[model samples]
Structures are given as C-alpha cells and as structure tokens.
Target: MTTRTLPMTEPATGLPDRITIYEVGPRDGLQNEKSVVPVEVKAEFVRRLVDAGLQTIELTSFVPAAWVPQLGDAEELLDLLGPVAAGQARPVLVPNERGLDRALDKGVKAIAVFGSATETFARKNLNRSVAESLAMFEPVVRGALDAGAWVRGYVSMCFGDPWEGPVPVEQVVDVCARLMDLGCDQLSIGDTIGVGTPGHVSRLLEALEGAGIGADQVGVHFHDTYGQALSNTMTALAHGVRVVDASTGGLGGCPYAKSATGNLATEDLVWALDGLGIEHGADLDALVETSVWMAQQLGRPSPSRVVKALAGA
Candidate 1:
C-alpha cells in the first residue's frame, strides 16, 4: 500500500507569487564542520541539491585553506561539477580580490562577498574595521562585475551580534547600502545570531526601503538559534522580498559567533512555502532524502523538524 499527501495551499495576499530559494547548503552549511568533508562527498551533495530542484545553489567559498579548511577544495569541487549550464546559478563566496581572482580563473560566473553590519563582528570575522572590509570588497566587487560575474553581497549580523547585542536597523541599512554601492547585484541580510522577531524584521525592511534599498534587491538569511527563522522569513515575504537563504538539514553555524546555531533549514522553509501556496521549486521528498543522507555523512540526525517528520513518515 502507498500513501499520497499534499499540503493545503492557502495563498497569502501580500507575498510574491514565486520566491527563489538561494540554497546555501554546500557553502554556508558545511563551512563550520570540525572534520573535513571530502571533495567527492561535497560534489555529491551539490548534485543531490540540484536533483532536489534547487535553482540557485551556493557551491563553495574560495577563501584560503587556513581560513576555511572545509572548502579548501573549491577548485576541485567545481571541476567535478564541470561547467555550470545556462540558467543554473551556482555562486561561490569570494572573501577578497585574491579569492575573486581564483574563482574567475575557474570561469565562475556567480560570486558573493560576505560583509558585516557591526564593527565588532567585522573585527572578529574579517580582522578589519567595517570601513576597511568594505574597502577590500570594493575592488573585489568591481573586479567580479568587470569580469561579467554576478555578485551578491552578504551582510552578516543584521539582526543581532553576540558581542554587540541588538543591531540597530539603521546600522544594518547603512551597511547594506554600502554593499549595494559596491556594485553587488543583490544583498542578503543575515540574522546571524537568530535573535530577530517578526517586528524587528518588519522594521529593518522599512528602514532599508527608506534608505532606497527595496525588498526586491534583498534576500533574508536567518539562523534558527531562537526558533524564529520561519516567522521572520514570513515577515520578509510579506514585505515583498523574493529570495531566501537556507541550508539543507540545518547544518551550519557561525564559527566566530559561538552563540549562533544552525541556519534556517531548507526543508522547513520549503514546507512553510508549500502551506503558504508560495512557489519555491523544490521536491520535498527529495530534499528530505538528501538531508538524511547528508546527516549520515555528518554523523548525526538532521536538526530540521520537517526533515525529521517526513523522513520518519
């Protein structure tokens, strides 16, 4: 006997008809692992994500091995994946001009630069002041754009910083604007410590709009430390944002921010989108299976509630 199931679609009035899930499992998800995940396993993870119908997958970062040893095989992994076909957006994280040079040499067409909204996080994560980090990114973003690669700017700690406590909406807006000015095609606002509520999310979006940065040009990346990731995501969707950053099986955390937890799980987000009647092109069953396999690789069960429930079912 076989059982069939489908979520009841109740479309929300103010949300976008379809939103792009910017899948970050390969890069952001595995970056904090203590043990090195082999290049072949990482390649298969990317393949599984593609098979699960994720349109925009962040493949890996080009930071030095000393910085992020988990993704040291960026070039080898890209080689395994071969040429990115037309219509597929596979973005790699480039920390500076040197990383950008390496990615461009590999014929990378999409790249992202990670930034911070607060001075403390900037110093801790990048070992530079916020201004200095932006200065470093200016040339990198320019070089990527000049090379015809699509660039995304990621502003971490948009909601709250462990060292700084609550981050002001105005501060986040300012950093986002600076990143936009750096020629980034899009900006991903990150709730690095998972401390944002729905109200905070709304106010931040409003402030960003006041600064001339509309939701159309932004995506939301939420961690689940406080279990508000889905609620915060709903708030963003209602505010006209159409892109969301999520990890498979809730796999990642910020290494610099020890208080931070796993990212907003892709499975949970997809389930929420399914119920909301929002169009996110992902196969729920395939995603669940992929997360289960990945969890096995990491020697633990998935932290995603949706993945657990579905996998058990």
Candidate 2:
C-alpha cells in the first residue's frame, strides 16, 4: 500500500516526563489468558499497577461469564479494588446497558464501549450488525455520560480482520466516526490480530484524520502477533496520538480471533518511550516486576522482548 506522508508533530523528545499507561491486564489482558487469575490476584495486580504509576487502569468487564469466564468476577473485581487516589481513574469494560448498570452500581468512573471495524467480526463478536451495535451503544454511551461517567470506545480490527482478511481504510474511518460522534471521551483502534505494519497504521491514522477525528482523541491498541506493534505504535506517535493501550508482561489475546496474541506489552512501550525521550511516569523496574509476577501467575513466558531482555540483561 502506498502511504501518503503527513506533517509530523515534534516527536515526543526528552526523557518522558509522563505517559499515561492504561493497564488493560485485568480486562483485555486476562480475558485472553488461559489461566483464570484468582480474584485476590487480580485485585493485587491492580494494586501493584497503581503503585507502579499507571494511574489509568482497566479493572474488568461486565460481559457474561459464559462469554469470558476468565473475568466472571467483574463485579467482585471492581468492588475489591481497594481504593483510588484523589486523581486516579479505573475504567471497566461494559458490553451493553446491563453491563453498564453493573459497572455503575459498582461505582465505575470510566467505561468502554467496543465495536469492531470489520462487519464480519462485528457480527460474529457482538452478534449484531454494525448499525445495531451502534444503536445499542448510543443509549449506553449516552447513559454512561449522563451518569457523570467518562466513556471510551474501542474500535477493534482497525487494520485487518481474521475472517475477512485486510480491512479497508474507509471502513475504519466510518466506524470510528460513529464512535466519536456518540461522544466517546477517547477511542482506541485495536489491531486485533496484530497484522498491522507501519504503513497500514499510517494510512489508518490519515484516514481517521480525513474523517475529522482529532488525533488527541485517538489511541492505538496493537497486538504483537506479527511482531509489528512497536513500529506501528511509533508511527501512531508521530501522528500525535498520545494515549496507548498495553498489558503487563504482554498479557491477553483474543480467544475468538485466531493467532491474535497479547497486546504490545507495557514494558515494551515504556522501553520505546524511554528511547524516544517521551515521558510515561512509569517505574520500569516495578512494571517489569509486576509483569513477571503476572506471567508467573498465568504460567506463561512473557511475549515481551523487554521482559526477556531485561530479566537476562
């Protein structure tokens, strides 16, 4: 794909004074893990994450346990999250109105609404047409915002899809516009199967720009299945997207989406930010320690190069 060049923002130069690390290890991360992390362990993970300077953390999703038994304790997880500091935020995933009610009842401040960029995946994942899902979210987003809660939207399979192969830039732009128009505080474009290259990422950002969604309202959520998350992320950064989604120790993968491994590890993102002189406010050593703890609890080797390299280095 031929890429059109865009004027780059001043790269995030200087040692990162701060980068908001949204910890998805509980919701997106654990949902894909094979081992069901105990509730105590899950809460402990959140506790540790906050201690590591990740103020924005995803607690869990209220989706039916039948859909993701790994996070059946969404309510419990939210309730058990000891407490938040004066300014910290802990967001949770809500599938629909029912999920939103459950999360709201548990005192969630931020909630996420998810939709896929591919129609096929949207139908398969949400069991509804794209229009139907948007219709469903309209009320959900509206209700959440009305309740004084911050609402974020997730756009999955931004670059490509498992069932239909590569997704079109037009498709991504249109869907993302709808999500933003629905009044999402921010939107995360996820490469569900990690098939995105830097070129694909650039085109998608340009398409989003063409659609008039400001760069500040967008985030890139990459899965490292094809080993392209970091470069793709840097491409997003150059486009002025600041927010990013990552999990500790590279945890999480799409159980429904084949070969879509865990997200770009938080450790890896911090490493890149460190090299770029961008501030993330994260304690790398503590973050790595948490990642190792998470990997041990899950009984899996971390997919993060930083984790392996640092542990050995």
Question: Tell me, what's the RMSD of every candidate?
Answer: 1.0, 6.3
Stretches off by above 4 angstroms in model 2 are 1-18
Model 2 alpha-carbon miss at residue 93, Å: 0.6
Model 2 per-residue lDDT tens digits across residues 23-133: 788788888767678999999998888889887888888899998899999878776875667788888889899999998888788999989888888888899889889
TM-score of candidate 2 to 2 decimals: 0.93
Q: What is the TM-score of each candidate against the true structure?
A: 0.98, 0.93
Best lDDT among the predictions, by candidate number: 1
Report the number of clashing residue pairs per model: 0, 7
Local accuracy of candidate 1 as per-residue lDDT tens digits, 1-313: 8674567888878888899999998998999898999999999999999999998999999999998899899999999999987788999999999999999999999999999999999999899999999999999999999999999999999999998898888888899998899889999999999999999999999999999889999999999998999999999999999999999999899878988889999999999999888889899999999999999898989999998787872
lDDT for model 1, please: 0.93
